[model samples]
Target chain A: MNKIQDIQQFLQDENLDAALITTPDNVFYVSGFKSEPHERLLGVMVFKEAEPFVICPLMEVPDLKASGWNFEAVGHQDTEDAWEVLAAAARKRNVSLEKIAIEKSHLTVERMERMEELFEGVTISRIDEKLNSLRNIKSEDELIKLRKAAELADYAIEVGCKEIAEGKTELEILMAIEFEMKGKGAEKMSFDTMVLSGPKTASPHGKPGSRKIQKGDFILFDLGVVYEGYCSDITRTVAFGEPSEKQREIYETVRKAEQAAIDLVRPGVKARELDKVARDVITEAGYGEYFTHRLGHGLGISVHEFPSITGTNDLELQEGMVFTIEPGIYNPEITGVRIEDDVVVTADGVEVLTKFPKELKIIEA
Target chain B: MNKIQDIQQFLQDENLDAALITTPDNVFYVSGFKSEPHERLLGVMVFKEAEPFVICPLMEVPDLKASGWNFEAVGHQDTEDAWEVLAAAARKRNVSLEKIAIEKSHLTVERMERMEELFEGVTISRIDEKLNSLRNIKSEDELIKLRKAAELADYAIEVGCKEIAEGKTELEILMAIEFEMKGKGAEKMSFDTMVLSGPKTASPHGKPGSRKIQKGDFILFDLGVVYEGYCSDITRTVAFGEPSEKQREIYETVRKAEQAAIDLVRPGVKARELDKVARDVITEAGYGEYFTHRLGHGLGISVHEFPSITGTNDLELQEGMVFTIEPGIYNPEITGVRIEDDVVVTADGVEVLTKFPKELKIIEA
Candidate 1:
């Protein structure tokens, strides 16, 4: 982990005169401040050799003050016209027009145009890759938060599973699960608590509905917990009653695939190759075509980040990078089966962050 | 309602060769296709003198087809990039994109750059005013959906008030209200349900917490219901048990301001003037400085759209424009009060869409 000064040294090593951090993850990684939800204000941390300055809306000054971070804080009244304040800060810092690096992935065309108006005759290029390289490895503090988040999710899911019985609607189950998380002291949910059941489970990202819980239905429960700005995600599918022969077969197939994917998570392994590890298992079982969407994605500040684990991704897995390994077989009209776990690449192998049982569970009520 | 021919004629009258509609509201308004959540695709509907063409991702083709709109649909493979497909569509139409009018208000800088690359040699300017004008006037179909959405919110709020009592956490009440909306068949919540109680209510956009409801505390519940694509927002503040003298004073002041703002909403009235109608009441009550944030904002496709009802807003209210008239007072460490309702300006005066009772209710446990 680098101090503010060490970050500048890294920037110098990367040949970036000054790197502008805009995305919330990049800002939290560099400055350690996580803004509230739906907040439109941006956090800009400019790196010189040994200094970093933050620019945000004026309303957030009190919050920045409470964070105890050592950085210059500049504020503007409204974000709609905050370029003048940011440009003035740049001028005050004696930043040259050339050699300025900004986040290519996060900066919008309108913001760039506004920057152009403020910092006239400046050369700007992408510094996102360098930032991503730094953020790919999580710090000890990050891991602690991640582990706590996973524990909260595990606890919430345990209670949610107990609440899933015949006659309960999908909406009721979702509320019960979220309520469990709230009771456990979670600030908010990492994502919408998914409680899709029966035929609706066929849609991987289906919103919970008022469908009543029926016997002999494939129930897909994908949920997460957000604790201290970090997130954890997990998915578990269960049979409400006596499962059909096809359901039993598909459940076994997905379980084996998920185990293979989790086993392949280790340092020095390519994320895409690991995805293929599970993808191949499902394909060999002749359910490859039914498996839709990516196997997994990186989880961090915003729930979905870099180092995606998909068959087409080429990024290599590294120590400290955490992500989910979720594989599913969706048969739209009939049923679906998916098993997910959050895995963090360790020095030698991998550590499963989610501790909930991954085996198929049959609950009859 | 005007057909595609009318849009083409409107584009011609505006002296724009081609207009790009990218915002979800504008896209649905023109093409009648609701964009799904988590969709990385964009809908670019091009108008050329009485004809329209839509360019959407291949994965969305099925849903778009079912929409029953007669337009050319381009579907690219899931693995393929979306920008390339959009570029090909633009070329096939032979659209001379020079001097193109675009939705600068909502288009991201990155997406706008991609549009430039597709056009190669073209000028793009803001079409925010024209598009906003088109979306502000509600049609019969839109009104029906809006009314339905309002009904759901009204019902949910009634249930929420009935359940509010001492010994309940804010998050519990919020989840209950949201689940109630889902029970009645809401596709999704318009936005995150806000259940700010006690002193936490001082912040207009405060997130719900585990703070238990207490006796003599003012509870402010702000929530919205989403039916189909349209949305409705309503806020109600009630006292747990009997109110203190200060609580009653603040609540009555906010109620008067809220009523005044709603009464001032009518065709030909300046939006700023309507905001002042609320601001004046709060100011006269000696809580002007405590009333942070805007008086109200437009409510339709997005909760906070255009024609913001603020002291600085310069736009004039018009017929068929629906928005919220919410006036609030925030006293940190004490209590807060806010009353909001959805109101539509009519040819004669104004029509309140939400029918929830506003009289302060005292909940006894």
Candidate 2:
């Protein structure tokens, strides 16, 4: 069955009268209409026994139709009460607005209050887990797009590495890399392109600035690209010049931990165990405290999706699940090194999608 | 008093014990720390009778400290219960949590439920409007950053117009503009740079694509830049070659409407009147229906802020308030034209921050 049919069946099985999909990612997955409506309302109302319909801003109706969604679209103007319009549409379809499932993780408190006021007797249940489960396993077509996205991410890393030189600012290198990605037909960066150098790299989520690259400095790059709505994220750290013995040790330790975690990825393995494998490797190297944050996270249409790979999560790794396995060791005063790769679980082993080499490379600056 | 002190006074006046600020922009405005904690929790708790504190992931503690926030930062690890940590912090401050305010517009339904469960006897109220009122008027320091950001945005339009060619794709022109912005020290684009040519420009929020420029095509460029936490937004439609009479007419109508609205910007004028001033101009030209959206919106730290310039809003224009005056006419089959400028209300009149000429420019492609 198709995705919409699968969702309809799920609503029936769960005894939900209808399901309100509002998050842009979930809405795109169901209706093939992608939009970032800032504060505007954009949703797809799927009924168990009635046909599904979409509601969006009036200005987006043409774009919605062009996205190939042929169902009834209820477009509301800025001055109109969108909830009242949505209720009218529901009544027209004769679908009882009782026991509706909604994406609670994404719906804001103000909107939920409005929904409650609109449907006074309705029981609202969260469909976050159900929707995540439906989008977890990758189909063949999704895998194709994912592989292409990963290839583009790898290409971005290659371009960034080549742009690293003495006296160049981190933002300058990032611009060069993104410029090359645009030339390669990338829709956009999966997230903000990160190029943190020296001690700034110690902050994993640091923003790139005008700090010039210098000798004996370690530069970190964490970037990705979106291709056909699928996203790929990869992180790599390289030396600008001959690094010190301590920097080299930290880089090698992170590479080994990342490889160890990747080797532990297969069907029937617990996600938490994979995290422990990487954590233990880093701990054995006496840098456990330096390895902050979770081991990795699931990646697909969104850069960070369901099934987080943390030491506490016990979700079993299954075939067709795609995620990232990244390991890092960061010291604020010294250096920071991270090695990340995208991989898909196979029937027995795992297929590594990102092909960037993880060895320690010192660029002659 | 500073912003935080103003909030403290607001809480006292409203009879609220405390307030929780969770939206990234508000948190940045109050604490001067900007972070995008995807899925993770980041908030600041301010009390009327006690000291304020911040709650964030453990990994962000150092960065939070570096942001010049000198307060108790409650950091929680991934495995820790952040709610329990937050409650402990509240107890340490001896602040009563019986009544609290929150940004209802931004807090998700799931988070609201969590908050309810954490503080069982607390009565929650919406603080969205209060915060907006506080941030509505720009301080002198903010005006300086906004003026610089507006200058950068004008420069971006100039670069984009120069890059127009017969065979260049919309994405190519966008890249050229963004590369120039980054080179000129822009931290980042306030929003995704839009470059829509020909009929595609009819969609005001259309994404840039691989559509190549052609003769007699009207290309719309709506873009902005962020400089030191302030944002600037500007839109201009330029002709690729000698345009037809119809295109020129539409362009002139929009230009006239935009200028008329700008001329109406003075203290004591209603926001709705400014919107009507522009709408009336387009309607007199028999293109009322073609202008499908609002005239413009408030601009500052965020591109779209409070005091929306729509025909329905009755908020009065006040000194120190900054906003945009944009007017557009979109005919799906023929073409689209828009002219926008950022302006700040002065003591007597107004100061147009963006200096790009609104006169129709036909580039020789």
Give the top-scoring candidate (lDDT). Answer: 2
Shift of residue B72 alpha carbon in model 1, Å:
1.7
> Candidate 1, residue A224: CA error in Å?
1.1
User: lDDT tens string, model 1, A1-365?
Assistant: 26455557766776666766677767777777776424355666565653467777778877876876667887778525666776777677665545567776567556676777776776677777777677677888889999999999888778878998898988788888888787787878898888888988888868887788999888888888888888999998988998888888888989999999888877778878888888898899888998987889888776887778888888878899989989999987568888888889999899999998867788985
DockQ of every candidate: 0.52, 0.59
Weakest 10 consecutive residues of candidate 2 chain B by summed lDDT: B86-95
For model 2 chain A, give the 10-residue run with minimal summed lDDT. Answer: A1-10
lDDT digits (tens) for residues B103-211 of candidate 2: 9999998888888888887898988998899789999988999999999999999999999999888988998898789878888899889999999989887888878
lDDT of 1 by residue, B16-78 (tens): 777777777778777887775243665655656424666676777888879876778877766
Write out the backbone clash pairs for model 1: A108-B109, A109-B109, A109-B110, A110-B109
- Error (Å) of candidate 1 at residue B177 is 1.2
Question: lDDT per residue, candidate 2, A1-365, as tens digits?
Answer: 27778888889899999999999999988888888887888999999988888899987899899998988998997779998999889889877788899998999889988988988888999988988997888888889989999999999999999998889999889888987898788888998999999999898778888899999899999999998888999999999889999999999999999999999999999999999999999999999999987888888889999778999898999989999988899998789889899999999989999998888988997
Against the unseen true structure, what C-alpha lDDT does each candidate score? 0.79, 0.90
Q: Which stretches of candidate 2 lie above 4 Å from their native place?
A: A65-71, A162-169, A197-202, A211-219, A238-249, A331-335, A359-365, B161-169, B197-203, B211-219, B239-248, B286-289, B331-335, B361-365
